[model samples]
Every structure is written in structure tokens, then in C-alpha cells.
Target: MKDILEIRIHGRGGQGAKTASQFIVEAALDQGKYIKAFPEYGPERRGAPVAAFARISDKPIHTYAPITNPDIVLVIDNTLIGFVDVTKGLTNKGILIVNTCEESSKMKEKTKFKGNVYTVDATNISIKLLGKNLPNISMLGALVKIANNISLESLKNKIKEKFLKKIGEEKTEKTIESLIKGYDEVR
Candidate 1:
């Protein structure tokens, strides 16, 4: 991990992009890192395109603006590849973690992205385990794997702490399972 790391998350509304960003922030904060997480959306509605930004650093982060050049980009919706410039402003050495059943090379080719690419079938995992299309939880696992800045145990603890009260233990467990599957399956 460097002094500062910026991450951009892309997903549609109702897909938990904001929640994913919050989890990252919480995990980083739990590790005593300075962090900021926020979401950018237009005409709040389900299925609308949404972007969430997260900044993590050992030192204070001065900027409050959306990340322009992210060290990592997580695409929770692979369909956004053509619809949006998901790779715009990504660093040349940045890592791209995408939720897709397809190969990373194919996704890179389709998006014309020249960077390290990782893919996971988060949607499938979520549907199987949680019976929903929410891939953010699973994507978090993939992000942890790719970013390597936050530990998996820290993230799981945060997820349990945040979601347990809202979704109950059984569902939270399923979500964590989906996340772990994503972590192991992302390549």
C-alpha cells in the first residue's frame, strides 16, 4: 500500500455501489487509515448509472472531489464497459476488477483498457447465495484481493458489523459467503 490510494466503483443504482465504497472506507478506517467514501449519481432511481469514489491514505486526504485518476477501478456492472468510459483517468498501472463471467482479456479488449484486469462472477455468486442481483458484497472481496491494501478479515468484520443489524445474521452470513467465493474465484 502506498501513502494514498484512490478507487472508483461503477455500478447501477440499487446495486450497492455506495455500500461497497462505504465498506472499503470502514475497513481502511478500522486499520487506522484516513479514508473518504462517497457516491455520484444522477436522478436517483433504480438501475441508473452510479459511480462511487473512495480514497485511502496513511496521511490525511486533502481533496474531497471525485477521483480523477484512480489506482484501482471496480466495475460491478460489466455492461457499463461500453456505455461509460469506465477506464477513463485510470492509472496505467491501475488494476481493473470487474464482475463478469467472461474472461478478463475479453473484457479488456472490449473496453480497450490497457491495464491489469481481474474478473469474477459476482452476480452469479450473489444470486446463488443471496437470491438477489446485488454484486457489491461479492465485488468487495474481489477488490480486497486486487487492491491488497485492506485485509479480508477486517472487511468481513466490518460487513458483519454494518449488515448484521439490518439484514440479520443468516442473510449476512450468506453475503459473507458470496464475498468469500468472489475472493477465491476472481482471477
Candidate 2:
């Protein structure tokens, strides 16, 4: 991780993109890192494309603006590849993580991204582990793994802390399980 790492996450409105961003920042905060998290919405509807931003730094963050050039980009919805320029600001040295069954080579052809790309089947992981299509929690696992700034244990604990009261212990465990699978299975 660099002195500061900025991340951009792409997903549909109801896909939990905002939640993922908050989780990333919250976990980073738990590590005593300065952080920021926010969302950008196109339409106010459920299926509309949305973007979320998370900034993590070891020192005090001075910039409050949206990340124009992110260090890492995470696409929670593969359908937005063509519809949205998810790689618009990613550098050749940056990392791109996508939630899809497609290979990285295929993604490179589609997105024309020259950076290191990682593809993970977060949907299937969530379905198998959480019994739902909630890719947000599992995607957190991939985010932490690729970013390498936030600890996986910190993230899982954060999720548990946030969801334990709202979703209970059983569902929280499933969410953590999906996240772990995504962390281990991303390629």
C-alpha cells in the first residue's frame, strides 16, 4: 500500500456499492488510517449505475473531492464495463478487480485496461454462502485482498459488528464466509 490509496467501486443502485465503500473505509479507520467514503449516483432508481469512492491514507487526508484517478477500481457489476468507463482513470500500474466469471484476458479485451486485472465470481460465492445475490459483502473480501491496506480480520470484524444486530449471527457468518471465499478465489 502506498502512503494513500484511493479506490472506486462500480455497481448498480441496489447492489450495495455504497455499503461496500463504507465497509472499506470503516475497516481502514479501524487500522488507524485516515479515510473517506461517499457515493455518486446517476439516476435515483434501483438498477441505475452508481459509483462509490473510498480513500485510505496513513496521514491526515486533505482532499475532499471525488477520486478522479483511483489507485484501484472494483467493478461489482460486469455489465457496466461497456456502459460505464470503469477503467477511465486506472493506470497501467494500478489494479482492477471485477465480479464476474469471465477471465482477465477477456476483460482486458473488453475494457482495454493494461493494468493487472483480477476476476472473481462474487455472485456465486454470495449465492452459495449467503443464499442471496448480495455481492457487496463478498466484494469487500476481494477489495481488501487486492488493496492490501485493510486487514481481512478487521473487515470481517467490522461486518460482524455492523450486521450482527441487524442481520443476526447466522447471516453475518454467511457474509463473512462469502467474503473469505472471494478473498481466496479471486484470480
81, model 1: CA deviation in Å? 1.2
Residue-level lDDT for 6 in candidate 1: 93
Q: How many steric overlaps are in each model, in order?
A: 0, 0
What TM-score goes with each of the models?
Answer: 0.96, 0.97
lDDT (tens digit, per residue) of candidate 1 on 1-187: 4678999999998999999999999999999999999889678888888999999998999987768989999999998889889999976698899999999999889988888999999999999999989899999999998888899999999989988999999999998898899889999
**Per-residue lDDT over 33-146 for candidate 2, one digit per residue giving the tens place of the 0 to 100 score:** 999998985666798999999989999999887798899999999999897999988889988999999898999899999999999999999988887899987778887888
Model 1 bad stretches (over 4 Å): none
| C-alpha root-mean-square deviation, each candidate | 1.2, 1.1
Worst 10 residues of 1 by lDDT: 1-10
Q: Residue 178's C-alpha lDDT in candidate 2?
A: 92
**CA shift of 54, model 2, Å:** 0.5
lDDT of 1: 0.91
